[model samples]
Target: MNLKYLIFIIILITGITLAEETKQKAVLVTGASSGIGLKVTEYLIKSGFYVYAGARKEEDLKRLDAMKNTTSVRLDVTVQSDIDAAVKFVQSQNRGLFGIVNNAGVGVFGKMSEVPDKDILWIHDVNVMGPHRVNRAFIPLLKESMGRTTIIGSISGYVTSAESGAYSMSKFAVEAYTESLADDLRETGIHVGIVDPGAYKSKIRAKVTMFNLTGSYDLNQELTEEQKKVLNAAKERNNKLKEPDEVAEAVIHLMTSDKPKLRYMVAPTIGAAEVTMKTTLGRVVQLNADQQFEYTRDELVAFLDELLKENSSEL
Candidate 1:
């Protein structure tokens, strides 16, 4: 054989070996019933990785189970027993878990004053503690694989909108906790990262609005008709969000890359928001710290006058 041909054959063999190594890797994705989690699971499976998709509903699990190269396990991140069962299912697969995508969480939108304590606690349970429970349950498996565990957080993790305080608080907690976890696991060869996506077209916004806020309250009596209109406008803005697949693609990129980043802001909107929050406007707002006092000082007259003026300019 020619020497050139022999060298070519050797390079081809090395490439094949690397591809095989990548194919053997497996991943577990939580909250696979719908939205971003479901889409991410589908993308991973299509890329030829063994995927364990977890959902609280068996019907949804069965739907994902029907897909090729995928398995579904019943998992409610809020429950430890369910998490244990999910871990056991992955262990039984015999592929050795390569990644854990903590994608299960919910959103809540309401003023902290209007939202009940019970609702706030529920948000924290599902959004913050849920990921913590799953990470704890699957850390050993992730460590065994010696790869990475990607946490699917949100843009709210870094910035808070007016009505989404509860949800934002939960995501902020997730961000801090995961960052600390990443540092702690750096030496162990098990990487940790966060995917903070902006608004995605998902059931989350509608579901949160429907479930977290209901019934007539005495607080509503105090709220003027104009205040109600402003609240509805905010909800409408959220309804016009982007698709979940955008977020799924980002998750897949983070998972498959050789050198993953510690955090990824999923879309341009999030990137823009982050930039704005770091700019002069954010600094000015923080420095003043008297918007609330100024508004209440004159029955929100100045606030409403400025708001109407902006609306007129837009029109």
Candidate 2:
């Protein structure tokens, strides 16, 4: 080849390498097939971070693969082998793993008394231990990068719903686990946080009302007239709810911040859950004079930060 052609080839290769190097940090987003997880993946890619998008479905993988610089992972957080495979895939990529969004979760609607043991067991496996599973598998990678970790939580973590017993139980467990994990990793360079979101237009809505996947305790069981009323109310309310962009922004902030709060309450409403948190945190924790019961995401996060700090210390 002539010198001019060789120079042109070198420039092309150099430009490609530069572009690749710009996305040096890769973040793993679980349950990335839809809803908040999908939105988070998109935001991260647009923000110029390489994303390892995890999904249990083939269609989700295909969609994520079409995006530039994203690795589509076949993952079911409850399954050990899937977690192992995802870790291996990230290893193959040779990119610096900067974070993991433990966003995979599901909800069920039933009274605590009526729900079967197996139902709660299955849920605990997914919502409670799932984050643990992902963390355990990705610890080495997270350690290498001193990465940040964010747990996608719910208002139910602190405030129980009248009908969603199994889901509330699991989320409460996740609440404790997130705090413990953060405390354990405090000394390490890695940062750990949680975002407890209220009603958001996500799969959780349909999962509870429509799909009803909780085998023994699901819709197959007959509902009381009261239960049906509650179901209808929830359906109506959730249907009218819009997807909370603030929730996604909150997660992204937690993942990317130089110094992130331990937890955030992503409720854009004066939710009943917020009321419970207010009372509990007020009694047990310090109060910020500027804080009040509110719908603003920033105020809620501030309120939660104080409460989570108290929880961590007690832990």
Candidate 3:
């Protein structure tokens, strides 16, 4: 090869390498105080990405701040001032935001009729409006990056478990909003996607219990000992949930992949169940619908009986 051509090729390669090295790409994760959000922040930091870990609590933020190559910012998704402050902080960093993991959410478990209107509203505000608030605040940064935004949603967004009525409703709304946002942002080179995790162990279960206890709403008058037992059993099952790190791994993959998918369902059982519902049951709705109803009823009844018997023995 000619000397001139060799020098030119070397220059081109150097430019590419420099671009890769200095290219500014940042990931901002909400609810990074704990659970999946904290795990995601850790993974991103390990992978050498500039991460802004946003949380409502100052202590959690301080913990993340102690890590190298990570910035911790106070962000309460439910509060607009906090959201605006976080956005301003990111903008000041000048690294250019690339991804957003909207993991801040709360769940309220109860019968729809039994849950107070205030509790329902609060759940929706956090689960649905919280993401919206964060997105609106940070969308400019996402757009500036041009098509690299990932939103962390939940599997509950698609399927509704009867026991967590208010939670399911909020997640359902989130699913709709995510889909719509994906469509809206498609042409603008700003990708909007959702990660629907099935069951990952987190403080969310304890938070759910706390919400139940602290809620001003009264339990259903018709709720028999049997119904209470079933509810408690369900809560126990949730307590033995999957690890948050697994879901965090999924978030990292979504954020880093060149051709990231629009929707990613994390766990095996929940993913399979969602696919089956959409492909099998979804097609023949009414026919298999009754079978699903019978299955759930039978399981709930069995769970209730076992729980009640256990409680009676304890008494």
Candidate 4:
């Protein structure tokens, strides 16, 4: 080869090598249109990671795509075709996937005995099965990269309320799913975790209420006095809730940390944390109430102390 041509080739090869080395690890965040999902996406991009922000609405997709270091994917977690296309799009980018944040979920509130079966199924489809579908579709990519996957669970998984039976059931199912997934991938060098967020400012309640009353998230339709009261209560609670930045921080840690935890409860207040832990302990007491092989109080306390020490060491 001529001297000048050889030098040009060297420069081209060097450029390609640098590009490969400097490429940012990409993370897929479903339901990135708003709330916790959007917060997680923003945090990842700002932390110098690439984000494939998934949103169902075209306008939301445009907004996400406009953000720095983001490629908005039109992913409807409930839709298999959308998920398939999203997987293909990520593959075409040639940036191997590093993590997935299953954040797309819906809420439902009503007496379990009277709530329509369709409504219950709808909540499950999005809140429970959505993560299942997305994770299954992307597990191959995750395995190739030895990446992490985290589900956006809720404190509701630990404490079920009277009117939130459907929603709580879905979240509880997510807890089980995450644990099972972690076990399945334990030896594959792929980490799995769950982030359970307490009440935070978000449109989930509004969406669920409106959809349940009007068959869609449309407020144009007139609501009954009782329904109006429900909406007002949600608004009041939202006004007092904090932003989900802390939840996003936990997600970032799970993705980047050397020893990521299996469960993270991102409660806004200490009271919230206490309530969840108490509820979990209450369940243990209930299970032991009439059991033949129940542990004594001292034994249970010892077990808890040991687990706490183990967890603190990991941190």
Candidate 5:
């Protein structure tokens, strides 16, 4: 073949491949700056996805911009303008969004009495409303591709406890919204899933602690000895952060599978989802029709007792 003709053919093939990539495979990840979201973006790009790595900070998106087959986008899940810009980027590609990882969230740590309502609202704004905003903006594109949406929920949502009220409340709301969103979108051929992580290494725990320390809570307030012990334990547990790869892997699975699971338990430690999956609560979670997922205090305490025994036996 002539050198000129060979070069033309080569260019043509390259264009075709790029076009297919733009047309058939595109995913957007919010809060792609760090932690699980960053890993998910990286994993998807390596797996041949046309990834839109959405980060609020330009500095954080630098690595993603430097990568091939990836577009760095400004997306603050709480900001409508950012969501709009992201939608426009996807539209310009002419490829509908194939998947969305609504991975933006924040943490607030304090006892119920010490955590202010304003703090709780702030956490809810990001953890709960943020996903809703992103989902609302991207529904059209997602529908066009018949794509899937993965909301980053938490094990905290199901197993509420002390010193995590502010964070847990937001996740509880997210859990309900995720379920309702899934039910509403099911008939439209759009799939939604929730990944409730237990524990892993991330900046979130540190953030929670920092917020707690810097917060205006009355340190002069007296506390029972038991309260102080519980408080310290919460801080210590959060400080033990682990790698976020497991959560990223779960997100990838949700994005790639033809029929993704509605709930994925991707945690570094054993959690309510894992324990429940093998016990009676699992049946309740899988089979419940109503919005209310409830357990009496006594029942939950007993369940935890048995769960601990089971875990100890495994060791």
Candidate 6:
């Protein structure tokens, strides 16, 4: 090669390398005003990824935008116009999205027979349909970038107790949605996953309490003695619970890992994990009972071990 031509090639390669080194991946996180979403946003920023933090309130948008490498988008998961605007805004940035964390969710605790239909709908709108809407709107960009998408699920999908039917139902729906979505996108490079967190310190309970008592999101209303006790207990329990930083870590793994798992159950305690697993296994046992080809306990254990081995493989 001629000396001058070789030098020009060297300079061209160096410029390309510099450009690649400075490039940053962008991720959109819904419900980023507080709790898990906020933690994920902060951690992503710390890890040097650009973030489009989605929040509904004006103050939250301002706060998020003030962060380095962060842009706050006004996104209310239940509203289609807001979602469309968000999609447009993201496209306008021209960074091209790399990942999406569907973390916006709501919780309601009430008896199935007594909970108002509107309350159930409200929770479903935020918890279940929220992810669906956001996913549908952003899937084009995700496909363009071959990006990853994760929904923030809950172990409540597996273990439901009294007065948690609605919330549990929505989570169970998310579990199904994630599985089906993964299957649908199997050929695409886009990865789909869910992070199910257990009892992380969050504002979900406070919101639930306020909605259950006052039928609105307002927290300034007067409280009765019973309501006060409930709020106090919830506050105390939340203070005892750990932050959801691990859940944020799980999300980061899903976004960056070459071989990310489809499901990440992030429980705050071993007992919570055990209960959730047992509840899942109990359902399996129930399904086997009185069936034509019921498996024995040993057979089930062997099958579980086989599954574990398969999941451990680099597929």
Candidate 1 lDDT, 1-315, residue by residue in tens = 999999999999998987775567788888888778888988888777788888876678789889887888888888889888888877876778888888988776777678778778987898788888888888888888887887788777766767978888888898898899999998889988899887776556545544534433222344456666654665586668766777777777777887777777776475656563564345545655665553243544676578779766643
Query: Compared to the true structure, candidate 5 yields what TM-score?
Result: 0.77
In candidate 2, which residue ranges exceed 4 Å CA deviation?
1-8, 11-19, 211-236, 282-315
RMSD of each: 12.0, 7.4, 12.8, 3.1, 8.3, 4.6
Across residues 83-149, which tens digit of lDDT does each residue of candidate 5 receive? Answer: 8988888898776788898888888876788877788888888989999999998998889888899
Candidate 3 lDDT for residue 287: 52
lDDT of 2 by residue, 99-190 (tens): 99999887767777887787678888888799999998898888888899888888778776568768888887888888898889888788
Q: Estimate each model's TM-score.
A: 0.73, 0.80, 0.74, 0.91, 0.77, 0.91
lDDT of 3 by residue, 1-315 (tens): 999999999999998976774574788888888778888888888777888888766677789899877889888788899888888888887788888888887778877678789888998888789888888887877887883666667766666655777887887787789889888888777877788777776667655654455442223334457656655765687667766776777777777776666777776475655663574344444453567454464665677689779766643
Model with the higher TM-score, candidate 4 or 5: 4
Better of 2 and 6 by TM-score: 6
- Badly placed stretches (over 4 Å) of model 1 are 1-23, 212-240, 268-315
RMSD of 2: 7.4
lDDT of 1 at 104: 86
What TM-score does structure 4 among the candidates reach? 0.91
Model 5, 303: alpha-carbon shift in Å?
A: 18
Minimal lDDT window, size 10, model 2? 210-219
Q: Where does model 6 exceed 4 Å of error?
A: 1-22, 224-226
Residue 204, candidate 5: C-alpha displacement in angstroms: 0.6
* Per-residue lDDT of model 4, residues 128-247, tens digit only: 899999999999999999999999999999988778899999999999999999999999899999999999998887777677666776545788999888877876777788999999
